[model samples]
Target: MALEIHNITFDCADSRGLATFWAGLLGWNVYYDDDPEVVVAPSYPNPGMGLLFIPVPEGKTAKNRVHLDVAPDEGTRDEAVERAVAAGATVTGDHRKDDGTGWVTLLDPEGNEFCIERGAAERGPRTSTAYRIG
Candidate 1:
């Protein structure tokens, strides 16, 4: 038997707006934002990892319980971070280790936490942020 992740869903305040933020952030396109309760990926045939944006209104009082640790598939780590920063995301801070093993934590449009870093294959140096799932 094997375990696989199907989708990462966010209970945000606005599905459409948040979807746009993430769509631009991850180079993902909208699946379907026409529905209120759900929005599938419209821009992709199968968004490798389905990113869902659902609606919630509690207002993210505390920090996120789960966070994404993302790697850049394009160019350098610095370039990847810049792209995210330009796409409606703000850098919370840098949390790299003295060994250069840390990640940049950024807040999405609705203030969700995610990270950007170099690919594990290259491993020139690595940076990681806190991440867990239940």
Candidate 2:
């Protein structure tokens, strides 16, 4: 038998709070929310992707192993950066290229790293390192 991924869980200090942040960012409603735990994006009437939040101490430090990379839904990458900054996300750094071949990496209100690439890059040609298996 094979396994399927239902959701992605994030270890956080407050499940409900963090879930609120994500729900706002993703425009997704709260699937389930309480004091200690929160499950965003419940399957409900249909299947759903999980965005779980669990409580933990210690604030985030250093880099994240897994980060969310997002491009702007409207306007250019720079515009998106402004929007993100306005949304309470911190600017980790700016890596835009002269030729517009780069993206901006951002940190959430809780210090989670996520990237925003231009729509062009999102749809541009991709270079793969995959090898065909015969």
How would you encode candidate 1's per-residue C-alpha lDDT over 1-134 as one tens digit per residue? 66887778998898888887776766667766357654445345655567778787688888899998888766766677888888788999898677756678999888999888766654664467777766
Looking at model 2, report the run of 10 residues with the lowest lDDT sum.
41-50
What would you estimate as the lDDT of candidate 1? 0.75
lDDT at 122 for candidate 2?
Answer: 50
Q: What lDDT, from 0 to 1, does candidate 2 have?
A: 0.75
Candidates' lDDT values, in order? 0.75, 0.75
- In the range 1-116, model 2's lDDT, one tens digit per residue, is 66787778788876777787777666566766346767777346564676878788887777899887877565677877787787888887889877767888888778888888
Against the true structure, what is each candidate's TM-score? Answer: 0.75, 0.76
| Candidate 1 backbone collisions, by pair | 30-42, 31-40, 31-41, 31-42, 32-40, 102-127, 102-128
